[model samples]
Target: MFDISMAEWSQNAPARARLLLVGGLVALTGVLALVFSLREPGSIAIAEWWPAASAAVAAALCARKHERPYVAVGVVLLVFLGLLSGGRSLELSFLDSVGNAVEAWLVAAIIAARRQQLSLKTVADVGRLLVATVAGAAVAALCVATGAHLVGLDFAASFVPIAAAHALTIVCIVPLVIIPRLHFRVSTPPKTIAISGALVLSVLAAFYPGSPAPLTFLPVPILAWAALSQSMFTAVFQLIGVLGGISALTIFGGGPFAYVTGAVPGIAFLQLYSFTLAALALLIGAAAQERRVIERERLALASLVRGAFERGPNGFAVLQEAASNWFELIEINAAAPALVPDSFEHSAGQWRLQRASRLHEIISRLSAGTEQTFEWSAAPGAASTAQLTITVGHQPNGSRTVVLAITDLAPMREAQRKLEEQLARERAISNELRKLNQQKDDFVASVSHELRTPITSILGYAEDMRENHGVTADEESLEVIERNAMRLLAVVDDVLLISRRNSDTSEPPARRRIAVGRAIDQCVSDLGRFAASKSVEVHVKVAPDTYLYVPESDFARVLSNLVTNAIKFSVPGATVKITADTKGDEVMLEVEDSGRGISREDRDRIFDPFYRSPQAIRDGIPGTGLGLPISRDLVHSMGGSIGLKSVLGEGTCVEVRIPLVRPEATQ
Candidate 1:
């Protein structure tokens, strides 16, 4: 025996399942055919009405397109065997089986062509099934009639019964099998039991012995009730029970259907009644199920909206617009009561009084259906305010409604106030620092001015003594005093220059077109003694025609400072070179020195005032750290830039670029 749950069968489930289904369908079709077939010779047209027809169509529909060929062959062979066993001749049985198989395949093909699912859940689904059933039944009936005519039976007399029987069978049986395949929540037991009891009672009353002929319609209401109030499954199940009861009672010659004059007419009437009940139950059940689904979705959406409205932080109010230009409060969410504590009527009256002008504007523009925002105080003249944003919309009946949302502005205003206070404090601190810096610059200027006169007097007296008392033993001491005095004067001059630059009262010196080569020569000459003392050679390379548009004094100061710095940092016998030339619209001046070069770390702030390098401090180099700053300031005041490039332990180069004076303009 094969284990069906084995991996092989599981993997081949589709192919295996279809094979099993085909085999089962063959067995079911054959059994239903034999059980329901009529043995009367004149009842050949009723072959399509057999239970085998329903089973054949249902199996064809259940089979996929690729599996239908095998299913179709099985249906034909099964129906033929069943017909033969029921005493039909071989030729007629084969033809009738062909018609039945064609009918089943036609129904399946029509549904597939329409791309409809097999389940009936909506009115449209019922309509699609109805259409497919009618079409398949008519075609099958014509085919059966033709086969009967070929066998010398009357086609016109046979087509109607064949068509009616096939259509009724499909309508009655297909949904019974198809609808139960869909999973549905079972109807509540109370309603299910109540409707079930009602249907059973109705069927028993209509089909009981000696019942009147019109009493057969009694079960219609019960079927309709089940359709409207019960699940689709319950409704369809009740329909099947009613059908079964009527057929069974009539077959026993006991029901209202059995009272009809002729057996054939009674069965026809029975089939008509059954078809009506099936249509009623299936159509109404499908519509009711669709309505339930829509209602369920609507209720879920309403709950979600209610949750958002109640839990939201913003205060919300719904108001109806009135003819008197006043809003009538209609509803409020959970947050609105906090913002509007007083009775809404009283608050609304106050709003109309206090905000009359804006209210008039709002009323005038509300018909345009735009959102407007305004500031509102809870009470008149209150400090804290809330922002009200109102959106206007029309209701379904053409009445206008306004949705107003309130957001408190007090916290935002408080944050803005604190930010302003912090900024004010920062501005005040910055202004005070500026004032103190100005005072310090003034003090330096005052002291440098005071020291310059004495330094000049000492230098003059010392020089006079050296000239007058020549060959004296103290001549070298006189020279030392003069040199020290000159150094003191230079420091005082640098301090005064810095003070003037920092003071707002001091204006830049008037610009003069000065020759770059002459300026370079003057700087080198001024530093000649300093460079000679260190045994550093000063080399000058400049294009004599390279002139700059700058203050003569500022230019002289800049070149002198750069050369002085270069000389001071130079190694003994290492050359200090000053070069200048005009490039593009500017004059470039570079002072290169073979010195213990500034390190990468110190190079960034080499021109900052009073910022001495770590290397210079470590080596005990004598510098007030003012030369480079003063140079930078003077160069900037002349609208130029200064930069330095250096490699530690290699030579350092200080480059300056100043706007060059054209020769024609200078002349």
Candidate 2:
């Protein structure tokens, strides 16, 4: 009933515009008729044809233009009135003029004398204006009737039909001609009943002297009241109005006197009609309102119920609370039913049952109540059996509901178990490798110790024989023995250091603040002959006051390695420069040699344990592979970082950075 479909443009807007134009033209025509009457040519008393013609023309125009053609027809009625005074040849009678003026006056008075202000733009809103117009016409007729009576003219019931005829003309014209045009936002139905009742009352009111029937419009003011109460839907309520106006008229209506004046002349019908229309509008509006609310609430509940049931991902079912043993199934959304595997529900009465999916088993987990769940298991030959978790919520209607959520955990759980096993295996292998490494270190240390004893004894005997027998111990022979012994000692030392670090039981190296300048000076002093033999100048740059707290022996070993490397790599005429200084909280030592330097690949892994460069091996550089590793270890024991930078065939630089913790005295 509350349909918005009527809002289509073909239905109401064009009609409203036509009605607005028609009403304006009709009123204009009426005024023109009056003006013609007042003009020359027998002072308009003879211009009877023009008045009628003008009305006819205006009505035709309004009929085409308006949805309701009453306003245009009213203009025509005013023009037609000229017939009474003999076509205005003589001065038109003042009585007829007064009656016409009063009709117009009353319509304006209803608008102006309104107790509440209104902005009438909708069909329901304009319906009240139609009522007022009819009632005003009635008042004019009643007044004419009363004035005739006071002058001793006999009044007749015949006046009633004339008023009705006039009113009917308005209704027919307005509906046929106007309502399809002037555009408004709201849709409004044609006002047939309201106009009819008002027209009947208007003719009844206007002709009688001092007629109260004009007051029929008193009820129409209630339209203003609905301004707030029925804003958008006011048109619907206006289409439907208070029905029993004729009955009310008959009850209080007895004669022309009773009819022309109000039904309860002074206080009765006026108040009753107004309150009744208002109360009735409120009542009918409330009914429409109530129906709308109920529809909305019902739709909402239905949607919520559907969402809960249909959107479930897993299997679900219902069972009767009364019969627990004979479980019968009713409806299911799942592919498989797991709960009622061995059982089915009774197909009778209000209590019904349903099934669960392949992975589910109905487990009675409810303690006191008759609620339960089903566990899901893997079904064979399926991609994977859906594992399920189920819960039941009790319905107030005494139906038990089961909800199942299926989850597959096979792949995830298996992967996690494998990861744990892998970790265990790795720990076992690490333990075995550690034991083997310790044994290897011990064996190397033992062999080196025994070999060193024999070599030392041989060397001492050879030295004695060379001195006593006056045999020449040539430089090459002496150098060979010395270099071999040193190489063996280096290998022995590397093995011992690795084993000690692995056990973590070795004593930490002694630490003391030693001046950076003094340490570099001592290394250069010791390496002077070595550098001199290679014809490589060893230059020293020392920051005199610089110092670092590190083991003196470890520092000496580190510096000795750097100088020996520089001398070994330097070209005969080139220089090897050693520099030392304090930088922030650390002391930096650098050794740079100008010669064919280490290659990129060798430079990267140069300090790796037992690593020897291809160039050094090919050149028969006599040294153990432990020199760089041992130097790095000694430097690290004193908390320092050892680094190298080199370019092929250009030069190499070795740097040791140590924390500077100056002591009160230095060795």
Worst 10 residues of 2 by lDDT: 44-53
Each model's lDDT comes to 0.76, 0.53
lDDT of 2: 0.53
Among all candidates shown, the one with the greatest TM-score: 1
Index of the highest-lDDT prediction: 1
Model 1 residue-pair collision total: 0
- Clash number by candidate, in order: 0, 68
Task: Tell me how far the alpha carbon of residue 351 in candidate 1 is from the true structure, in angstroms, after superposition.
Answer: 20
For each candidate, what TM-score against the reference? 0.55, 0.41
- Inter-residue clash pairs, candidate 1: none
